[model samples]
Target: MNNIELLKSSMINIVENKYSFKNNGLFQTDIPNLDFYFSSEPTEFNAIIYEPSLCIILQGSKAVGFGEELYSYDYSKYLLSSTHVPAKVKILEASEEVPYASLRIKFELEDIYDVIKNIDTNKLAMNVKSEKGLFFDDLTEKLYEPVSRLIKLIDKTKEEMDYLAPLIIKEILFILINDKSGYFLNKFAMEGTVSNKIVHAITEIKENFNEKLNVKELARLIDMSESSLYQNFKTITSMSPIQFQKKIRLEEAKLMLLNQNVEASEVAFAVGYESPSQFSREYSRMFGMSPKAHAIYLREEVS
Candidate 1:
């Protein structure tokens, strides 16, 4: 069989025999920078603050998108996010017998610069207008090989694996840097670029999700005009600044409800909602359930 075929076969074997399909959810592997995800059935678009990472599908297909722009991919393609962006991910295909399996390799922005500085300038200049932070590229054999190797390293001893994992990850990053995705990656990694500045604006908003969203202040913080910030923020995140902040607030509130036994009203106030009734209205609209009801549902789910 070809290498790609071999990679998928072994991945299924390792996941079943090694991990035993543990929780049917996100699996944090021993590798500090790597993780595996599984879902037994199709799911709705889950709004999340996607981190910088390279995600590859092993057994099923998926999509990551924001606003009206949706990118769908399977084993034959890979998804790359060069910076943190507000987006939604959905499992398009999966079942109990053959669940959706995928792996993610996380990297920091600084992790990218070392490779960027060493890349050929001519290649670096190829795709400079990275209006969006996310992209889906055809997964060539050249890209698949390192990913296969990364999957295999999950079985190695900590000492040996630690020494080798970074090398393989860097190799993968290097390959992407030389491909079309490099345009987006480099755009975000470079200092003073509009994409990077937007990243800063996003960081500020996320760090202070409980506070009111001030478009003028955020634009000034990123050294851009209000019109420019609003336009580009929507362009990159597929939503306006206020929309992104609202999603963050509600998502955070839901997480708090699921993990803690806090009152819905309490969570509403804590996440910057001045009126509990308003929070309940917005929360129910987004999540399809009242906050208090959602909390009870989570409690029943846990029991």
Candidate 2:
């Protein structure tokens, strides 16, 4: 078989053996940096917080929407996100005969930095405008080989995994830095760059999800004017600062409602909404159900 086909075969084998559940869910891998996702059929778009990671599709198509753009990738393609961005995702292709299977591999700033440190930074462009933090690119054999071995490492002896996993991961990072889409990620990793500054703002909004957010203050903190901050932040995250904060709040509220035996009203307040009605209205708009109803639905889904 060809390299691409061989890689897919290996991915399908690992996924079927480790994450064969009929329902849609994330299956944790032996490595902390990796996870497998399975979906049996098409699903509605659901809000998600995507960390810095690379998502490789093994067998089906998926759609990830952020702000006004929707990115779709299948077995021949992969998605990369350089920052923690909130997005909406849906499994667009799957069934009993062919389930949607994919892998999510986490990456850290340190990984990117380590790979770029020895490279000549002068060759990297600095004037590139920040677009959406994530991009879809065609998968290459250069990337897939390492991924294949990484999957095989999961079933290896503990000593083999501990010694080989990091090396494989570093190779993956090296491949990413040389990818056509690496320009955006490289810009993100460079110290004191505009993209890095905007990342700081994104981090602040996420960490202070429950606190009052002032765009003016955030701009000042990032040492940029409000207009510059607004443009770059939207360019990178695809949402206004306030919109991002609201998403963070509602996402946190959803987790609390689903995991804790708390009332919807209490969740609203805990997530920084002063008026429960306002919270309910916004929550329904985003999730398509009342918080209480959604919580119940999730419970029934698992049970």
Give each model a TM-score. Answer: 0.92, 0.95
Off by over 4 Å in 1: 125-130, 299-303
**Clash totals, every prediction:** 0, 0
Task: Flag clash pairs in model 2.
Answer: none
Against the true structure, candidate 1 has what lDDT?
0.83
lDDT of 1 by residue, 234-277 (tens): 77787788988898899899889998878989999899999999
Tens-place lDDT digits, model 2, residues 65-148: 988888888999889989988899999999988888888889887788888897766666557576778878899889999999
Best by TM-score: 2
Supply candidate 1's per-residue lDDT for 180: 78
Q: Using alpha carbons, what is the TM-score of model 1?
A: 0.92
